[model samples]
Target chain A: MTRASRLYRSSLLVAFAALALTAGCGKKQAAPPPPPPPPPPPPAKPTVTLQAAPTTIEKGGSVTLSWSSTNATALVIQPAIGNVAPEGSTKVSPDATTTYTITATGPGGSIDATASVNVTQPPPPPPPPPQPTLEELFARDVHDAYFDFNKADIREDAKAALSKDADFIKAHAGIKVVIEGHCDERGSTEYNMALGDRRAAAVKKYLSSLGVPADSLTTVSYGKEKPSCTESTEDCWQKNRRGHPVLAK
Target chain B: MIRQPRTPRIALKLHWFFAALLLAASPALAQDWFRTGTGLGVERPRVAVADLVPRAPEATAHGKLFTEVVRGDLDFSGILELVSPSFHPLQSPGMPLQLNYKAWSDAPASAQMVAFGNLQESSSEAAIEAWLYDVRNPSSPPVVAKVYRGAPTDAQIRKFAHQFADEIIGKLSGGLPGVASTQIAFISNRTGSKELWVMDYDGANQHALTALRTISLMPRWSPDTSRIAFACYIQAFGILSPQICMFSLELGRPVTFPRFHGSNSAPAWSPDGSQLMFSSSMSGYPEIYSIDANGSHFKRLTFSAGDSASTSPAWNPKTGQSAAFISDRGGFPQLYLMNSDGTNIRKMDLPDMGYVIDPAWSPNGQLLAFSWRRPNGNFDIYVMDVTSHQIAEITRDAGRNERPSWAPDGRHIVFESTRGGSRQIWVMLADGSHAHALTQSGANESPNWSPR
Candidate 1:
């Protein structure tokens, strides 16, 4: 915009210089002192350029601020960087967004150029998701299938539990587990040992049919040796007579 | 053994019995004894065993032990009733010459047969003279007369008594060999370790055979009673592995058997003692496997589809053609019959839904005794007739009677029970009569009768 205005003014000045020469020959009306002849082009306007290599940066990051000027006798930048050479670059690290303006001054006038460096705090790294432990996963995803007294047959509730168990097992292809068959204290130690196995095996067969890898399962019978509940009530026994799945090392 | 009276010339009878002297070992009359043992006899005769006579003051202790042991043996013999000592005549015969038969057969004594014995113990050796006679026909002949001589140790005295008692039982039972001298191999933790132990059939003189300080279970004596095959928790190749372990009675040490992979346990010796059958998880599931007695030839005896746990294989003592074991291939564990070579597997389905485990074949192979946890009840010992598949629960309402192993006679069973407030070893007649504890302390379990 300044260059256009300067060019138009220079053209008018040329026409005036011609009129002054004509007036000098005629001596008509007290002629104003003719202005000095306009140079071929306006004094080369001072041009200032300021640039930041990386317009945006992290809070702890830095950017290169480069600047140059033409036909300037002096140059200076705002925002902490003061006087600088006509053409130079400097690395600036700012904790906040900042715009640097470099002013170039010369015979014609002063020109200002600006470059912005935007600094952001980078969305606090997504709080590391609370990853669930394998044990917790087992507790949540794998369920125990309960049985009736002296029974290894899968009941309706047991099917539902095992259905979820199969999904969990299948979802985690790398997981290996021991399906423990537990028996109530009502059975004999040795007999329950086998009975527990029956329960574990029943669950395993069901899971296998549901697409669980057979090799990933190991069955063990705790029998009446390891009871979840020790009370003589039926509720405790029911808790014991269950097929439980656990993560294996 | 004396079949005829030989003391008439030595001393004539005038209320005094004639003398008999015979020191010979008699062959077992198995047919006669097997009849009584089978419980088919019409009547059990009342027999009286007179208190042993100590010929010398130094022999009195041994005499008492011998007398009491014989009386106890007769009490448990099943074929006869023992007359209480209180009903015994005050003056027992020291020798045949001192016997008054009428006294033995009279009111207070009232014994159809009389057994008399005398012991003479020296510092170095002990000797015994024992005789059995039909008090009703005392003048005819002596039924049994024998002599025993051995070192004067207490062990020797007990041995002599056992020999005398076994002789009386064998002769009186018609021909069934007595188990008095037979030893029972069991697992005992009296020494603070689950070790293999051996005791007399009547529960005396128990001593540890293995001090491995590890768990040993389900001990079964070899057919020859020389080696005990058992399940042992031991380290093999630096890994804690459950493996079949063997303890040699003759060698008096734990003999090395081949070590297989995974949890190998519950060992059963084949009837011939040539091979041993055990449960092994080496194939990723518990299955029956057979290895030579010397640990050379290894063979898999069971193949359950898709990781079924099949274990506890018992070969028939009489027919060696088949074996009885427990398998869960049918959803729950049930008795299964398979050929000795692992062929012809058949499930022994019962009339009820339950868990059947610890399948043990009777000595005659006609029956399989196991623990079945019925749907309506807890674990109880059950005996199934192999031919008829008729099942009878021998143990009921007893705190979890399990692991029933038939005695060598096939008329009695030994099992583990929790009825006594703790796990203990118990024995009963095959019909579940006269149940008594053989072990009372330290959590005994998994009692397998020796195959005498």
Candidate 2:
């Protein structure tokens, strides 16, 4: 072979070898870059579950919220009703029937479940008719004049009863009443009479508040006289400690 | 005169025996045999008046009618003396007319009194008849006083007799009436309740008038016996409200007057009964207020600071302008007097008495009856002369005696006490004599005597 032809053949062989080596290096570098990007993403799975808890609590009524996926650490619940409970075991009071969503998460991934309940109200009964009697009306007035234990001034119950009495007075314009105050037999006659007077005045004031004419009601204290039942019992005492409306001649 | 009759010896002997028996029964023969002569030259036989009258086993504590009447008659005549039957015994039984003069003359008394009566428990008034005699002058007719007091209890008979003695004393002293036939109205808490009760001035014939379930306090009577006014609390608006209510005893019903907004108590009626003055808190604190009989117009009489609560008002009937009341203006309660229109207010200086309340004017306006509380926390009824302001305590050891009221005749005062562990009514003489309990039940207070 000629010396120039031999040199051409060697140069071609060298160029072919350099091209094969560059191709092998490019293939190894591409495989390592993809594996590093995937490893960092696994830590972000916990955050995904935390973000999902608020959505689960939408239209909240009685509900308990929880989160777990943010970290492999223990789950935390805030503003606990009683004390810390197992995950997904917390109960809330005054539960209303409504749709509820529960969220669960782990280091691997997150998931949510939804439940629903129906709400309804029962119907009410009808009101009773009014029955009018002198004694009954007086009793209603007396019941409204005083408060229960440790209470000064009239209570709501008394006011309600007085309202009815006032309505009756307004309806019957010609009927004038004398409010006779009475007390239980536990105290002195003079003291009881004074107490009775206070009771009668209170009734008159309530009746006036309910639009009854003040002139139509005269207040007097009978003290302990005229007990409806002459006995010494709690029930009798309660009955005696009252005011009575009598028709004025 | 001489009589002679001849008879056989046997018949003559029988006649002599009969004549001797007749002689033994003769008054002159019996008296001559019983008479005895003293060493001082045949001293006259003394007599005891008690021996001339029938008596119980023992003389009553205050003396019996016969003993008292004889003593009174002898004391009035100033010419006779009496000796106790225990020392000089003389037995004369049955009625006064049946008395043996000879037997009574032998007693150590010169005069005697005889009394007879039937004591009944069912009635308060008693009927008694008494006579006075002089043993030295057997021919002189006996003096008698017939007393018909309604029924008197056994406990009261002694008092009744004392009253008769008083009458005899008055007759001897030339003119004072006996302490009898007087009635007292007082507050009683008997019947398990407080009520106004009336009894004989000597503490008998007690009957309650007020029918109150609560405490009936401070009872005052109108000038006429027809009505009464008292302070009581009536239930009003579930609270006890004090009031001054009038009760017409004849009508048998109670009518309450218009009470001021606050406490209306301690009522005192005007002499004419046309108006009533009372203590009220209508102006935020207790003050004196007067209201007409119809309760139409209420006039506030006083205005003072410091919760000047006025209580127990009294009006002078004669002057019709002066009034007295209890005022707490000086940090403690004291008695104060003022004009009827609330003018000329003055404090009464009552030394040693811490509190004074419930003033009642005597009918004659000469004195005032009131309750004075001592520093030791005890209360007693007292009477003070208006002119001299001389105070006299009427009750002692009577726990919480209060609300003294003068009787219409001004001879007695009624008040309330807690002496028996419960409030009761009591009566005593104007001079603090013969005090007795009038009420037996409930808690009674504030007694006011009836004007009549």
Candidate 3:
């Protein structure tokens, strides 16, 4: 139907339509309520800050560990310092350089930060002065004191030699000497060992009496094990029975 | 010379003379020889060791080894002399049943006793039957008739022979068994370093007891023979220091004891095995100290002030009541005697040899053997009569002989000598006669005879 002609023909129907619309309008109407404005963006994630006082220190020194965090219900520090409050500080004395980390967590998410300390080592000491070797001391400065067969008594000649030895050893403040008592190829091994010890001790005693430090002298026995001369003659044996002074390091 | 024969009168006279000779040579006649005179020099019994006869052809090698070992043991016993096999009769004494008393009594082999053995051998084991015969009285039973069974290896054969020899000595000498089965411990550097070693009394089967690979000296056996106390150089704070260490032969390892601050050396066990005596430098100078065997009661035996040194303590094996030690209190090293309680110290009455050291007491407590050096630097082993103070030279003109240790029987001594071009162990009569090398090779020293 033509829109205008249909409208004229439906005038009467239109009036009825109007009355029905008015009745319909009188009934409760159905429509979507305007959507609530989009929810506000979620709150930003919580943040944390960890710091240590005295960032640099010498060995055996201590440091203060401080931390701050937001929105975290619980927090902890690893490696022995277990649990701690969200915002607190503690002291630590780490033998070595170390780093500390802090973490914060919430419904928005989590965040972490760290701080470190530096350490410095002390400088090494200077090298000591060169020391005279045992060979040099024995060969150049000290003389062996000869003794009679099986005798530990200091002879006049031995006294002269030992005096020189004492003087040389005393001039060097830090130097110590060991008196070795030796015997010729004679006697029981066990007895000779003791005899040698006595000879050395006798020399040590003589040296000590001469004002040498007693602690700076020691004694050992070679018995007949180490003979300076291998020949089985009187002269060789005489040479072997002596108190030999050796430098001790 | 022409012979005068065919007379019954002359033959009767000869028979009487022969009978008298047999009586004079009897063991019973010589039994009191050692106790009759001054007991210094007595004739050793003449013993003939017959070749060990083999029961089987396969046993010949082992039988020879056994015979050699037995002969060596008897020779070294010092209480007997082994009649050379060269003196044996032409006919072999195949077994005890076949032994001819007249043959053993012949000239050059008139043995007072004869050791006869028979060996039955298999692939790995042997049964040895040893019998000691009284050659003078063949009608009487054997002195020792034993059957020993063991593996026929060289070591086992030697062991069986030693056991049989010990039995013979015990029966004949009426003293402690022969040291044939005993072992001597000494120091050896054959492994490139000085260490403790043990061997048969005859120097067979020598093997290291301590492989410490460091210097170990003076291995002194405990009275009970269960442990060896020695001075071992151990690393302490990176320095080689001598310390007294104990090794248990039963445990086959080192044992722990109290550690002193300084040197601890020259360990000797008390006769009763209740305590240990050692020299310690803990008091600034080497001095004698003693501790209970379990290391409880630590007591200083010497308290010398200053640089005086007292060391090398040897306890009397009988009572542990007296000790012989070396001290520098005298102008030189000299032997000193002290009570076990560390009191009543006295200078030993020793010869004025320039230096006197190493005093070993006899098991019978009669003599002290030590080395004495003369003004000419000649050292000799001199045995001093502890009571009479009579000193006798045991060794003379032999390469340096030292460190004399008395055998358990007190009739023989073990010592060190350089007479054979090298330091070696030697065994001799207590009077220093019949010196024979116990160790043939290597430079063996510091021989300590085991008291078994």
Candidate 4:
């Protein structure tokens, strides 16, 4: 029975095959079947462009951030500004050197773009200069005048110094100074005392002539007791014989 | 001429003559060193001072002290030459009766005169029997026979020694007295403060005369030696100012003085001690001012204007008619003479140009001794004949010898010198011989001799 069924199936296949061949020969050649449809053009990649207008800004200054994306379904900004619209610009102020990142997400994939803004600060300034004290000012302004040996009279060369001392006394209002007359060690203490008085008086007289009041200037004689310079030389003696002005304590 | 024999008649006559001379004790003789009188012009006497004999065993130390002091005084008498003690006899004379004249008058011990004494002492009192003899003429009476009895302390013993020495010096030198008992007034910082101090002429018995606790300088003894006037830094108008201050040696106290407004210093006393002359800048310039000793009368002597200063006046002790002061009126500090009332001012110019200051009139009113700084030398003490203008430098190459003060004897001078490495009080003969330091403990300056 199996053999008889197999023989009948074979005779049917032969009859259908002969009928398909007789149909292909009777019509024009059928067109080739269309190729399978290509992938929907890869859903255009989500192209992104990010920029910071005024890329360099000072600290505490604002900067504009602009970004554009093609074929992007959602757009977001990082570093404090999240969920932003695509193809739009926004203002951002970064405290310190910062990098702003923009992310775009679409059916194709995700993209990230960054823009860095440099913030600069100026150097600290130096402290203001300290003010000079009153005594210091007086010392800088006042001067001393020297005398010849054994003579208390003002010398021609000492006139300029005495004039400047007078100006200093006059320039400072309400300031008092003591003009100390000094002498060299060549003379006795008693005689030098008198000579020192004369030297100091000479200075006071010059100052008075220059408009400084006598009350504002006092006189003292150190004589040979207080030598400004101590040596046995003539130069040292010249240095010791002077009319020295001191600020009143 | 033949030497006289030791006859009894000649011996009796010489005894009365020598005895009369010993009793006279006359300083009125014309041979005084300070008097500028007619001098004896004799050769300096060669004398020997024997070690005092101690009557008691406990008086041995005091006896030696007395002997040494008498020897020193006689040696310093300026008119006497001392015989070396090495040539003295080994034995001390027990008394005049026991003296060995031949041993003293011999060649090795060639002493024309001899001083011998015995010191007797108890625990608290002492008696000194001193005698000066002419050993060549053994029969002559003693030149000086003195008995001094006092407390047995060192001071009293020293006093007795001075008395005995003075007696011998006066008799032998024909009237010049020894300066052993005089004092020197000066500025000393020995008590941690510059105060007025006084010491014996021989630099003993030093003591302070003030407790001002402030600086005092340039002490000037009054003519009477009873008070001292000096520049003292006293509080005036809330400042330590140099002003004239007085101290009395008798009362041992500070005398009040008028406080001026400016520098007042370097006081000088009149010959009669009636007034004090000083320099004051109260009138805007330093000028001479005269005030009464009682601090009442005030008179300005000098009227130098502008920068001219006249100060440091020394009155003519003999005449009292003129004064010598220092002035810078002619550029340098030079000596100037003026009447007591500030008239007839004249500059004392020298042959050479130099600084002359600290003019001190001599006791004779003939010479002026001052500190002069020559153009080519250091400050030295120079004596000038005021009339002839002849200057003689007494100090040379001795490290700034200055501030010369004539002793009452006028033959010795006391001054400040740096020869010993620091400022010290130094005494020397007026001819700049025999310089000796009187102060070595502290920095001493400006020594003023006492009038006595």
Number of the top TM-score candidate:
4
Highest DockQ scorer: 4
**Fnat for each predicted structure, in order:** 0.07, 0.04, 0.17, 0.80
Tell me which residue pairs clash in candidate 3: A150-B354, A186-B379, A187-B379, A188-B402, A189-B402, A189-B403, A191-B357, A191-B358
- Which parts of model 3 are misplaced by more than 4 Å? A1-249, B1-46, B101-112, B135-139, B236-238, B257-264, B303-309, B350-354, B374-377
Model 1 docking grade: incorrect
State the lDDT at B257 in candidate 4.
87
Write down the worst ten-residue block by lDDT for model 4 chain B: B31-40
Q: Which candidate number would show the highest lDDT if scored against the true structure?
A: 4
- Per-residue lDDT of B108 in model 4: 89
Q: Estimate each model's TM-score.
A: 0.67, 0.49, 0.65, 0.75
Superposed on all Cα atoms, model 4 deviates from the true structure by an RMSD in Å of 13.3
Scoring each candidate complex against the real one, what DockQ results? 0.08, 0.05, 0.10, 0.52
- Give the alpha-carbon lDDT of every model: 0.78, 0.58, 0.76, 0.81
lDDT tens readout by residue for model 4, A207-234 = 8888999888888887887787888799
Tens digits of per-residue lDDT for model 1 on B73-191? 77776667789999988999979998889988998878888999788888988989999888887676877899989898888888878887878777766566777777777777788
Q: State which candidate, 1 or 2, has the greater DockQ.
A: 1
A207: Cα error in model 1, Å: 10
For A141-229, candidate 2 gives per-residue lDDT tens digits of: 53334433211245676677777777877887877877766677543333344345556667777788788998788766565666776
